[model samples]
Target chain A: GAGVSQSPSNKVTEKGKDVELRCDPISGHTALYWYRQSLGQGLEFLIYFQGNSAPDKSGLPSDRFSAERTGGSVSTLTIQRTQQEDSAVYLCASSLLLAGGLDTQYFGPGTRLTVL
Target chain B: AQRVTQPEKLLSVFKGAPVELKCNYSYSGSPELFWYVQYSRQRLQLLLRHISRESIKGFTADLNKGETSFHLKKPFAQEEDSAMYYCALSGLANFNKFYFGSGTKLNVKP
Candidate 1:
């Protein structure tokens, strides 16, 4: 079975540009998540989607960051007006379920974004 | 405020020697703990979880609520075990939001 997959392994853009990173979660997985890994920093939660309910956007760092999961499978994280601080590896993960259950999240290769 | 802590950023051990990676977490409610590992050029993957009570690759972790720790331990270290290990915590009430540690890079020398 294919694990979580992400597109555009690497991306480079100038400051103030907008970029979107894509993620294809494992088939049948009901949960999707996005995280950012800055240099020498731990993985920071970004957003989460489960089934068809409202997503948990508490982890999103700023208003410039937004994510959406369509058809409950594919997810996209968009960073508007990119900043030098946004340079990091954007990671996506998925799990079978997350609501009051024990699940392990499988991660994708990640998209390394560089904002110059 | 849920948080996971990995005090050591890097740990070096010799082949065939015992290995221990310390992890501490802070959360008010009951928490589910997990250990994630990423080998060189590999994506992060779950190594083990506290709920499963199973060991993978000779590694085991005992969750201690009293001490608020879930340290990964192995009797003998293998060169293949060298990688980056992250300690993560998920709150019981929250929707499986994982808070990861700073991660520990393990180096095993033969």
Candidate 2:
């Protein structure tokens, strides 16, 4: 089975520019999550989507950061007016079900975003 | 606030030696813990979860509610075990949101 996949494995953008990172969750997955990994830092929770429920936007760092999951499969994280602080690896993961304890999340290869 | 903590940034062990990676979490409600691993050039994947109480690839973790810890351990380390490991936590009420630690990089030398 195909694992979670992210696009533009690497991206470079100038400060103040906007960029979008895409994620294709595993087929039949009902849960999707976005995280950011900064250099020498832990994975920071970004956003989450479960089935058709309202998305959890609490983890989003700022108003410039936003994500949307369409049809419960594909997710996109968009950062408007990119900043140097936004340079990090954006990771996407998906789980078969919504149970946190029982469902195991599978991660994608991550997109390394660099803001110059 | 829910948070996961990995005390050690790196752990080095010789092949055939015992290995332990410490993880502690703070959560007010019932917590779900998990260990995720990433080998060189590989995407992060689930290694084990506390609720499952199952070992994978010679690794096991015991969750201690009293101590609020879930330390990952293996009887004998293998060179192939070298990789980055993350300890994650999620609350029973907020299962979809995972709080991850900084992660520990393990190095197993032959």
Candidate 3:
């Protein structure tokens, strides 16, 4: 079984540019999540999607940080007008359960984004 | 407010020595706790969960509601155990959205 996977293992962009990071969750996993891993910041939850319900964007640091899960499998995190502060590893995860059940979250290899 | 804390950023232990990684959490309601691990060049993966009440790879954690802690421990550390560990919490109040700790990097010397 394929685990959660993120594309563009590494991405380097200029400040003010927009970058899109992709994530492919495990098949049949209804819950998808995005996180940011940075130095001294740990893992910060950016957004979450469960099935068709609205996403939990409370953890998103700013309006520039946005994510979308299409067809309930693939997700994309887009950082608009990227800033130096946005330089971090973007991680994605998926769980087997739905409806708020506590399940193991399989993580992706992460996309290392650098805003130079 | 829901939060997970890992006081130590780094912990070093010798092979065959006992190891403990402390974790504390703050949440208004009952929270499900989990320990995730990441080895070098590996993605983060589940090491254990409080609900499962089981041990994996010679590691175990006891969740204490009274003390608000869930620390991972092992009787004897192995060099292969060296990696990053993260403590995470999820509860109904936050709709099961996990709040993760800053993570602790463990170094086991042989």
Candidate 4:
């Protein structure tokens, strides 16, 4: 009955510091995704994880952006050496399956990350 | 690359008037289109999907392949309908990822 959830609702850090955003997908969801929303870029897909197979890292902006899903449930998005441009709202979503169509994704409240 | 476009950054309408939010997408294959909405102080949630062909909260969107558009429409706008609406597309080729538009902020004035 619970929807997706994210931690660290708000985080403020200095440039060059590392920040981690966590997401807890809904129960039995096999697909998890990370997205960033900001004034400049709008909403951009960062990464996705499906089951235990290899994760899709193509959407990641740079090498500093990385994510990992432990045991196919919880996911952590880590941004190393955070830059001022990395300031945005980090949103997490999950779906029942990874099929190509009609899969409704439920989103979390998102964590607002501010890199000063 | 697939892309979604929302030409209008903001759309304002009077309550009880017709409202339409335009959305256009670029993709080669049959695409799964979705409308997501976020009210003030609320999380993003799915409003409707084209495949389902169902209307939610009196809002409906028709996917036009010829024009590459899927505009959200409601005959009578309500104050509660004001929010940020995003058009998203997931192509069959890249089903794992979704391309979202810049989002249109709808303001319903009474």
DockQ of each: 0.72, 0.73, 0.67, 0.65
Kindly list the per-residue Cα lDDT of model 1 for residues A16-68, writing each as its tens digit.
Answer: 99999999999988888889999998999887888644456778899999888
Q: Which ten residues in a row have the lowest lDDT in candidate 4 chain B?
A: B89-98
Worst 10 residues of 1 chain B by lDDT: B89-98
Count clashing residue pairs in model 4. Answer: 0
**Residue B36 lDDT in model 4?**
97
The TM-scores, one per candidate, come to: 0.96, 0.96, 0.95, 0.95
Q: What local lDDT score does residue A27 receive in model 3, on the 0 to 100 scale?
A: 94
Q: List the residue pairs that clash in candidate 2.
A: none
Listing every candidate in turn, what is its Cα RMSD in Å to the true structure after a full C-alpha superposition? 1.4, 1.4, 1.5, 1.6
Local error of candidate 3 at A83, Å?
A: 0.6
Question: Could you give the TM-score of chain B for each candidate, in order?
Answer: 0.96, 0.96, 0.96, 0.96
* lDDT digits (tens) for residues A2-56 of candidate 4: 9999999999999999999999999888888899999745589988788744356
- Indicate whether candidate 2 or candidate 4 has the larger lDDT: 2
Residue runs of model 3 more than 4 Å from their true location after superposition: A98-100, B92-95
Residue pairs with backbone atoms closer than 3 Å in model 1 (clashes): none
